[model samples]
Target: MSKRSDQITLVAGGAGFIGSHLCRALLDRGETVLCLDNLQTARPSNLRLLERDERFEFIEADIVNPLPLDVLERTWSIGRVYNLACAASPPQYQANPEHTMLTNVVGTDHLLRLAERADARFLLTSTSEVYGDPEAHPQHEDYRGWVNCTGPRACYDEGKRAAEAMAFDFARMERTDVRVARIFNTYGPQMHPDDGRVVSNLICQALSGNDITIYGDGTQTRSFCYVSDMVEGLIALMESEQVQAEPINLGNPNEISVNELLTHILALTGSDADVVHRSLPVDDPRRRRPDISRAQRLLGWQPRVSLEEGLAATCAWFAGEIDGGRVPRPTAPDRVRASVA
Candidate 1:
């Protein structure tokens, strides 16, 4: 392996929504990035922009299994590892519950071992789902979640919980340098229109002139962090001089109800789509907002994008995809892969 310090970064699931953006950010900083993904839930179009970059290399592989160590050793000396691998959306994740669990537990273990061997700085991009149907409002990192291990969402919720456990264990027992970011609801360009996430669903339904489906009474709330802001926070947390063994929340604190978010989407698209209410999925969190005090105190980072601006930019990207006929209409069963690690 080339022993060039701080030159190579390994981003597992680097072709997915937020991962793709992180890949771009790393390349922008003049680092050689080895992006690993199975293209399971990640769209190939997301990597189109980085394909031509001489410093970017995409490896088609799954992290649930051991990585190709010989190839990794010959390719570059990895200095940083970002474990962003896992299917994030509820529908996408629940579709393959067992695989999702393996991706989080087994996949995380594989990467943690690699980080240990390489002596690289490791950052695990955990999700807000770890705080399942959170009992606490504006969840702080210290709050143990109110999760249903037997419920439909348990696969993802518990999977992430287990991943965090493994990451911290590695840090304490194996002396691995580790960071964890409990990412909340994030939306932006490059999001899969068919992923069934609320932000993408609202934008795509409105743009397609379909009835906007609100899963509950539309009273459920979520705080959304823009993709760029999220990527920035991840980088900041990973590069911080201070050790962060405990997970830190990385998300926008601006909370808005589902109805209000739909209203904004409707107004932005100028679509006269009818509103439709549906049954809420079991175990869905009624409200989710991050208490980012720890992130601010630790990394000196806070989200700068407003919901309005981020939504506008996201809408424009979907509009282009629709007009260009490049958006793939992924079927429900077909969407069943562990998207990112």
Candidate 2:
């Protein structure tokens, strides 16, 4: 429920990596926020700061079931929604591919329907994976993508693609106001220690001086966006009146190969670890980068944080957590154990 004048905004996965940041951003804007999450993959502590705000409320609910009609009735004044509930990373999504697909397809379907019922503007947090491996070097918005429908990763890639399609249908047919962002690789503090994302994995391994693993000759490249920059981009899109604009790429264009990233991580953490090669996962993209011309022209948005600065902040966070007995110790070089002990 809003406090009379405060506009309400709903964040479906408000406890997860990107969602928590968005929730805080809304709170900063003095908007009342209702966060609905099952906490299946999200840590409650991520949003611990919001517990005291009267304007912020957390609901332990899944989006797969019927929308929380009761909450909606009480807070029916919600003006916007940021649908970010789906499992994001490979480890989490691939663990239960069927549910992951449903979370995207069915979950988006349900949210769009709710947006229709509430007359609220909707924003879907889609992924750059929707573009698949990409024959284009820097993927633009119009690329149809090179996704294999039968591959394991398709559950997430195609699921999001389908989710975007559904959102488009709602906006075109129902004339609902909608915005979508094809988010690329984003990393920052609060990422799960075992999330298995490239940035997190590299940082965690480097912190403990573990053998940094690189797949497929460490040649696959990725563009990394800091979480704060990504949140800013999402906010810009939300504030825009771009009806049915559902596929804009939101990512940093500075590309780095896996090996180069690991080297930087080692330098950042001062970790003496050997880089090791492993087979690339099935359907892993050989390269990816976002062409942000649309974002620049439309929203005047671009990522400002340098990789070194972002990684340093993230490394400091992980190091503090490790020293304070918050995050678990990793199987790394013998050096870090001595530091922690």
Reference-based TM-score of each model: 0.94, 0.93
Each candidate: RMSD: 2.7, 4.6
lDDT, candidate 1, equals 0.87
Indicate the residue-level lDDT of 328 in model 1: 48
Candidate 1 pairs with clashing backbones: 85-340, 85-341, 86-340, 86-341
| Tens-place lDDT digits, model 1, residues 208-307 | 8777788889999999999999999999998888755899999999999999999899999999989878789899899999999999998999999999
Pick the TM-score winner.
1
**Runs with alpha carbons beyond 4 Å of true place in candidate 2:** 1-5, 242-246, 331-341
Report the lDDT of model 2 for residue 323.
Answer: 81
Candidate 2, 182-299: lDDT as tens digits: 9999998888777667887788877876788776898899999999999999989888754245578899999999888888888888999888877788999999999999998888
In candidate 2, position 67 carries an lDDT of: 75
